[model samples]
Each structure stands twice: as C-alpha cells, then as structure tokens.
Target: MLTKPKILVVEDEIIVAVNLGQKLKKLGYDLVGITSSGEEAIQKAEENHPDLVLMDINIEGNLDGIQTAELLRNRFQTPVIYLTAYADENTLNRAKRTQPLGYIVKPFESDQLRSSIEVALYKNELEHRNRKNEESLKSTLNQMESGIITTDENGLVLFCNPVAEKIAGLSYAESIGLSLTKILKLEDSTSSSYTLPLSDVLISNQTIEKNGIFAVDGIGNKTAVSIQISPILNTEGKSSGSITVLRLGESDNTNQSYLKEIHHRIKNNLTVISSLLSMNASNLKDQETLDIFKDSQHRIQAVALLHEVLYENHDLSSISFDLYVRKLTDLLFEVYKVDRSKFKLVLDIQTPKIPSEMGMNCALIINELLTNSFKHGFKGRESGSILIRFSLNDEQYFLEVKDDGVGLSDDTIAQTRNSGSLGLSLVDSFVKLLRGKLKLENENGCKVTLSFPTRHET
Candidate 1:
C-alpha cells in the first residue's frame, strides 16, 4: 500500500541480501533490485534506474563493487554507496577510487547507514558550491591587468595568474611551486646589502613593504614595482603562508625635462643679471658690497646649473655624476681659464646611481674647491696641474682635488676658521648635506678632500 523507494542492492551473500532488503523496507524505503554479482548490479542499474545503489566490494563475479559503481556512474550518473564487511584499508581505498558517495562497514547500526548517506549528500552540496566559486575567482583573476602571485609557507609560489606569468616570462604550470627568489631572479636583488621583503613574509610571519628600483629581466625594460608581502593566516589564526601583492608602473620621466629646463633658463637669466649687478657694483667704491653681490650671484648660478643638468636626463629620480663633473669643470675653465701648465683638473671616478640632491652637493663642492685653487694656490701662473681623484674608499666615495702651485701660509690656515672666505664656507655647507667630511690641507699648495656615503650601490 506504500509508495515504493526504488534501490539496487549489490551483495554476493544471500543472507546479507535478505536482511538489507528487510531493513530498508522497515525504514520505509523500497528495494527495487537485489543482485549477487557486479554484472547483475550494473545490468539492473541501467534498466531499473534506482535512486541509490548499496554495493559490496567483494562479489561473486569478475568485476568488483568499485568496478561496478564506475560502470554505473559512467552509464547512468547514479551515485553508489558501498556496504562491505571487510574494513581492510586496501579494499576501502580501492572502492574510494571510483568516487563512491558513501561507505558502510558491516556489523554497523541503522543510524550509521543513515549518517553516512546524510553526510555524503551534504559534502556533495558543498563541492558543487566550491566549484562555482572556483570558476568565479579564476575568471576575475584572469581579467586583472596587474599581476597576482600567492605563496605557500615555504615561500614557493602556489598561484600565479595570467598577468604574473606573462610579466615573469614563464608559464603558470612552471612558475607554481618554484621558490620566489630563483624564479623572479631576485637572488641578486637580495645579493647586496638589502634583503627583499618577499623573503620576510615566510620568516617572521609578518607583512613587509619594499620600494626602490627592481631591475628584473634587464635595465632596458626597467618597470617600477611596489611590493607588499603579507602573511596568510588559516582559520585557526595560525600563519599558513603569504601572498605577495605587486603593483607595477613606469618610473617618473615627465618631471625630468621640466626640472632641467627650468633650471637652465634660471641660470642664464641669473648670469645676465649678475653681469648687470657686477657692473653697477664696480662703479661703487666699497669692495665689500661688490664681493657680497658676487657671492649671491654665484649661489644662484650653482642652483641654476643643477636644474639644467636634471632636465637633460630622462630619469628625474637621480643624476649622472660623470656628466655633472664635466659640466662643472667646463664652467671652472671659463671662470679662471687656468692654462694647461697652471691648475689642470683631473677626474678619476667609478660609481653610479647618485641621488639628485647629493649630485648637486657634489657639483657645489667641486666648484668651491676649484675656485679656491685659482684664487689662492694658483695665483702665480694661469697654468698648473690640479689632480682630481674620485675613488671608492671602503664603501664610501671620496673626491680629492690637489694643486701644486703656492701653498697656504701658517697664518692663512689658523685664521681661516669659519668666516675667512665664502668659498670655504659653501664647501662646508654642501659637505654637511652630503653627510661627508671636508678637509683642506696646505702642505704643498692646497688639497681639498670630500668624502660621503653613496645612496646606491654600483
């Protein structure tokens, strides 16, 4: 009189079959087909189309329960649950390979059977939701313009979307599971004094940030990237791993030309204005007033030259030291016009990536030292050799200018404390900005040495 619940029961034993059928009926479920062999179960499942199949692993025929479930799954998409007497791991594992919906060990309670079925259904629902979420996440990540790379506890890259793989010049399959240092060629980035922030995410389990020049691939591409590495905590609030967020863009270039041009124009205008002031000051009797005007003009010109040079460079971030040095030497040549036999400026240098402010400091320091040589040391002749040596002195950079003409007197050395000359005072000021030491020795003519720490490595 009851509405039947169709089911296929696959068991090799007759007693177990009769008991399972009786139990399902007592639980208000119908037994549609009961078979002794896997061959019969598959045949019955194809024809009967039961709601579920209770399959036994050990059967009477060539095919086992798992094999039969696989065949039924392929043909009818029907879910299978195994009811086996043996709890041996290998037999259970074999049954699991077919992706059975549930498994029940024999000598089990009726509730155990119900629980497995309920849990299996719940897991199936969860898996369906997870699949949809995975598809959505993958689509969004692929559409992103920037890169996204996620790492595991070991710092090995676990996930890299399309953009990341493209930027890194590797396939997603090849990039995943590879250590970040080796893959990004960041070995050299941390090869120097600085350690890359990505390395810290796995160590201290803390978020770290890094911003500077990252010359991966080569200097030609030279894309600037800001990286944020944060620890990924599991549900238990423990550090499971880290994810590195990278935002990349080109470095500042527009400011380069603007800065240089503005300085160049200002320098030219100051030069003309200085000439007018000098002519007017010359007409006055007081030499002190004339000297004041000259000092102000020189200070203005110093800042002006900095602007011109910066505008010429493509990268506004820093300056080219070699070019700056040559420009100053040329300006000194025009001012003093020191003959080849008098004070010749010799340049010996080896360093790179000088900060903009530091490079300007270098220019002003050289200008002061060179001007002093012409005014004091090289007073006798317009031609004398002045050796300018720029050497790397134990992690520091040093600039030494030496002249072989007339030496400073003992009185000149003692009296020249702070205010004796504007040249010496300016040199001291620029040295302070560079965080360097400035010393003037008058043993044989005069030698000025300025040493400072480099902002970047060569």
Candidate 2:
C-alpha cells in the first residue's frame, strides 16, 4: 500500500489554516499540522518531516512565508506551494524568488489545489532520483583504476576523476574549464608531436588506442602510458565531446625483479651440480665410464647456460638463440680440449629469441652431436670443420649440424638405428619430442638436419 503525501499548512488566519487542512485531508493528503506564523511552520515541518508545505506569503512572524520556505527547501529539501490572497506584481515577484512549486490566489477550488500538489510531488520525486543517479555515477568513476577525463566539444575539460588528476598533475578545480591539451601533456613515443589528435577522433567518431605513449607532467617528468580516446556521440550520430582513458604501459617492477632472482638461483644450483659431476669424472678408472660422466656434465652445463642468459637479460620470457649458441659451442670446445688450429667451428644462425624449453632441447641435441663427432668422427683425422646452421622459414624452425669428418660406417648406422649408441638415440628422441623430422646424410661428411613447426601443430 502507498503512504499518503504529508503536508503542513502555514496561514496567519486560524480560519483559513483550518479550511486548508480540511481540504488537504479530503484530497488524500495527510495534513501534519496547521500554523499561524512562519516560525511555527518551520518548527512543525521539522517535527513532522512533511513531504510538502502550503505556505502563506503574509504570515505573523519576523520571517515571512517566503523566507521560511526558502530555509525549509534549502535545509530539508522540502517542496513548498504558495497560498496567498494577493496577486499584486510586487508580491508575485517576491514569492517567485523562493521557487515555490505552485501559486494560487485566495479561495482556490479543491480541484485546482489537488492538481497543483500532485504535479509538485511528481516533479520533486523525479529531481530526487536524478540527483541520486548523478552521485552514484560520480562515485563509480572516482574508484576506477584507469584515469578518466571528459571534455566538451570545444575541448574544454568538463570533468576528470581523481586518477586523471594525478596523472595530469593537476587538481579537479584547476583543470575544469581549461583546455584538455593544457591539462594533459601527452607525447607520442613513435613521433615528435606533443599534441593529441582530438579533432580526428571527434570528426571520425571512433575510438583510437595508442601504446608506447608518454605522459609528461608540468616539470618534464615522463611516464610510459597507454591511452584510448573515444568520441561521445549525440542522438543524431554527431560528435558531442570525448572521453579519454589512461593506463600505465610498464608492468609491476617488483614482480619482474622476483622472476629474475628465481632464474639466477636456478642457474647457480645447476652450476653446482655440473661442478660435482666433473669432480666424480676425474676419479673414474674405465675410459668408457669417464666419457659417460663427461657427456652428462656437458648436458647439465647446457641447461645451466640458458638460465644464466635468462638471468642476465631484462626480459625473462625468452633468450637470444644466436647468442646462446655461441656461448654453448665455446664451452663445448673448451671441455673437449679441441685445438683451435685443427678444428674449425662455423655458425650461420638466423633464429631470434626462443622460449627456454625449446632452447634447452636444441642445446642438448647440439651437445650430443658435437660430442659424437669429437669422440669418433675425427679419430684418425688431423683437422676438420663443423657447421652449425639454424634458421626459420614458413613458420618452421630448421636446425642443421654438419661435420666434414669420415662418414658414418654402415655398422655404426645400424647400431644407431637399433639404439646401440646412446648419443644418436638420444638425438632421435629429442627430435621426436619437438614434433620434428630428422634426416641423416653422408655426401662429404656427416650432416644431420632437423625441422619442426614454430608452434605445436596437429
């Protein structure tokens, strides 16, 4: 059930006040109180908290009806309607200043009074709802993480949230009414222009996103930020204004530091294991067992080298494959004690940075193949050249390891196929893990070629 609209009556004459109260009750409005003075009306209004006030312009008090209505409206947001006997120009003008909801001459009809009160109540309710929605919108915008700023069609700042004020290095009071360009100093990282293309956005009526942009402050301090600007269109599809959003381009520095530290610790632990393997290999009596230990040590070092590269680079996602290969080959030559004058290492690497997991597999494959060549391929030769070529084409990676040494014997090839040789067998397994194809050739030497997709393919 709906509650009745509460009303208070203020008239200097006791008879008129009683008549007005009776008429309000008959109109389905709850008459809270009747008063003969402005002071009593205010006191009654405060006590009753009526929804509407029927105020008489001529009241017996230091404060007139107009003065009391203004105070009630301002303090309690109460709606007031004037009930007066005079309609003189002076009295009408004074009553209008109070912004009453309705005005009536003396001896008004019941229908007229009812219609006036209904319209006033409806209008006041609509205004109250609008104010609440506006406040809720403001609160939401203020809590957003990204900086938000709105401007008029002429580019003057209309409103900006707290985040926007912080990013622009200005307060809301100082920014309003100023040109958006003056408030926000944006510099394009790819260009030399310091101005934003707001006109283009307004004309095109489209949103534009920019990355690697710098937000410069008043004192020339620049922070990397990403920005998006969209035009606010009216009902006719014409640009009315614009809204801008700003976000920092750089990620959390603390998280990046933590990741680098983790990579560094992992590398250190692997190095310790590699050193322990070398120590045990020195005390081995059987040459075959010692070679096994050496191969394992080299494999461990290969993975450790990748982590070292990752720790040193600013980006922890991937490492430069070319640089990593260079370091790996150098370590292999030093470990095998190959004389630089007799053995030549040629590298034709064109691949860029690759993920750590893929890099580790490739490193192990290279280590095993090169170790095989050093142990048996050039056992009776005085000198030979090894070529390590890695390239990418058609969304696939190609890795080739070739050595100009005595070609593999028929028996050795049979043993490799039968898994008799652990080195070649391991290479085959690594190739299969990469979802790749491997080919062995013996034109002038031993050439091993492997091909795989850049990403996993079904």
- Give the candidate number with the greatest lDDT: 2
- Per-model TM-score, in order, reads 0.44, 0.50
Clashing residue pairs in all predictions, respectively, total: 8, 0
For model 1, residues 1-458, the per-residue Cα lDDT tens digits are 85454678999889988888887777766688899998888888878888778988888899988888889877887778888777678877777788888888896777786677657656755766897998998788777756778878778888877556534545567788888765564322443433457656666778887766353531122435566778888897766878766565445545544665666677788778878877887787877777667656665566666766665444556665666677777777776566654446677645433667888888787777777777677776756777777756577888887888786666656544465777777777778778887777775678777889875444
lDDT of 2 at 297: 80
Question: What alpha-carbon RMSD in Å does predicted model 2 have with respect to the real structure?
Answer: 28.9
Q: Taking the tens digit of each residue's C-alpha lDDT, what string does model 2 give over 35-72?
A: 88888888898899999998888889899888999899
For candidate 2, give the lDDT: 0.83
Model 1 Cα shift for residue 454 (angstroms): 41
> Residue 379 deviation, candidate 1, in Å?
98
